[model samples]
Target: MKLMHVDASPKGAKSNSRMLSGQFVEMLRERIPALSVDYLDLAQDPPPHVSGDFARAIYTPEEERTPQMRALLEPSDAMCRRVLAADALLFAMPMYNWSMPSSFKAFLDLIVRGGVTYIAGPDGYAGQLARHKVLFLTTRGADLRDGSPFAGMDALTPALTHGFGFIGVRDPWFVDAQPLQFAQPEERAAGLARAQAELAMVADRWAADVMSEAA
Candidate 1:
């Protein structure tokens, strides 16, 4: 199976989320020896924001579009094709001002196309990219889990879930290392340990499932 791993942290190697994701990849690699991974660091290479020309290319018929229109949409088309090609996607991101990083959002804008990824059906909207799985590895400086005092303030995961679901991911699961800034050393250590253990379970299960299906 193929996995697309996206890192949206601007801090690069210093990012805790990045470290966790790297560990996840290493552990998963042991389970699925033949698994192929394509990594994208959005902080280093972010997609362009949606523009008027991109809008025109998407709205215009493919054959009728000019070279300029094609050029405008080329990057977006490539990004979408990568997602479509992958069997599963894994995202590692940190919270930024109660939401995702702007680089990740920009990447989404370049990929989410109208007729290419979705269309208006006679009945209702339909998603072209379906039956895919998504895993979200996230870190937060503050507490925002289900029972935290600031539970209602988490605009990150909800927004991401909606955005990814809109593009046709059927199952999206999240494992978080929370309260990074607020936790004591022991608490932080425990949280990281828990997150890594959960990741191990997820990876082992997914690898077994894929192998069984292929068999």
Candidate 2:
């Protein structure tokens, strides 16, 4: 199976999300020896933000698009093709100001194409990647767990869920490590541990699915 792993953290080696996401990918590799990986590091090589040219190009029918329009949209189109080719997707990033980082948001803007990733039908919308599995690994500054003062304040989770669902990942998995920056030392460690443990289990399940498909 092909797995597309995206690291959206600007912190590089200091990013907990990256560490956990990489570990999960390695676990999958261990289980599925032939698993192919496509890695994109947003911090190192980010796609350009959506521009007027992109808007014009995407809305224009492919047959009618000018040469310049096609060139302008080629990068975005390639990103879309990568997503479609991948069997599973993994996104790792730290929440910034209660939402996604700007780089990751820019990346999403490029890949979430209209006709390419989803279809807006007369009745409703349909996702093109309905069968693809997706995982979001996020690190949050504050604790948003049940009974915490910050409970119900996780705006990032719902936004990601809906955004990805719109593109056909209706049941994407999320493993969020919170209270990393604002909690006690022990609490941070505990949260990290919890995220790692959950990721291991998720990797197991994903690997099993891959093996089943191969069989």
Candidate 3:
């Protein structure tokens, strides 16, 4: 099985999302010994923001694109290729200002190409990546769960869902560790534990599916 693991946290060792996602990846590795993982650290090598040249370049027919347009499209094309090649994708990020980090959004911008990742037809848009599954492992400083003061404030979840769904991923899974920064020590521990438990469950199910398919 091939998995693309993306880390958007700039905090390195101090990032909860990174830790949880890494552990989950390791869990999958344990279950699927031959699993191939392609890692992308957005903090270290982030995609450039989309520019006017890029917009024109994607629309331009490949055969007709100028050298400048091809150069401008290279990063986005590379990212799209990576996404297309992966059987599954795992995103590890910390929520920033009620949503995904800027770097992660930038990464999305590069990969969500029309002809590459999706097709726009008269019926609207059809995503090309329906064969791939996705998992988002996120950490938040605020309590955004049901009945909490920050309830429904999480724009990140829906954004991620629709963004990737636009390109064909369906029913992506999320494991969110929330309120870690402001919560009491025990509460933070509980949240982390909860996320870990969820991760284990998800990993088991995904690994089983992979093994079953292989058999």
Candidate 4:
């Protein structure tokens, strides 16, 4: 199976989200030796933000699009193709100011094209990238679990799930490293260990699911 890992942290190697996502991939690799991995570090190579040209190009009929329109939409089309090619996609995300990093948002904007990724349906909008599984590895400075006082404070998970769900990546798994900056050393260690275990289990289940589906 083809697995893609996208890291959105500018923190580079020091990013906890990056660590956990890599760990998940490594564990999955061990379980499914045939798995092929693709990695994208958005901080190092982020997609260009959508522009007026992009909007205009997508609005134009495909058969009638000119060279200028194709040129404007080429990058977005490539990004969407990569997503459609992947059997599973794992996003390594860090919460910045209660929201996703700007680079990640830009990446989303580039790929989530109207006709390329989604389209109007008889009922409503329908995503073109259906049947692909998604897993999110996320890090935050504070706890924002459902029962926590800071529940709605997390702008990351909600937007991530909603946006991806809109594209038909339904019920994506999430591994959260939370309150890392505020928790005591022991607490932080314990939290990391717990998340690691959770992710390992997820990897195992995901491998079984993907391999069985492929077979």
Q: Which candidate wins on TM-score?
A: 3
Give stretches of model 1 more than 4 Å off. none
Residue range 20-93, candidate 2, lDDT tens digits: 89899988888888889999999999889888888889999889999999999889889999999998999999
TM-score of 4: 0.93
Ranked by TM-score from best down, the candidates are 3, 2, 1, 4
Which residue pairs in model 3 clash with each other? none
lDDT of each: 0.85, 0.90, 0.91, 0.84
- CA shift at 8, candidate 3, in angstroms? 0.4
1-215, model 3: which lDDT tens digit per residue?
Answer: 89999999999999899899899999999988989999999999988887888888988888999999988888888889998999989999999999999999999989888778999899999999898978999999888999998997999999999989899999899999977898899889999999999999999999999988988
Summed backbone clashes in each candidate are 0, 0, 0, 0
TM-score of each: 0.94, 0.95, 0.96, 0.93
Off by over 4 Å in 3: none
Model 1, position 105: C-alpha lDDT score? 88
Off by over 4 Å in 4: none
- Candidate 1 lDDT over 45-164, as tens digits, reads 977776777777888988999999988788888888998888888999998888888888888777677777776779776776676778998898877878989899988888888887
Q: List the lowest-lDDT window of 10 residues for candidate 1.
A: 124-133
**Which candidate achieves the best lDDT against the true structure?**
3
User: Each model's RMSD to truth, in Å?
Assistant: 1.5, 1.3, 1.1, 1.6
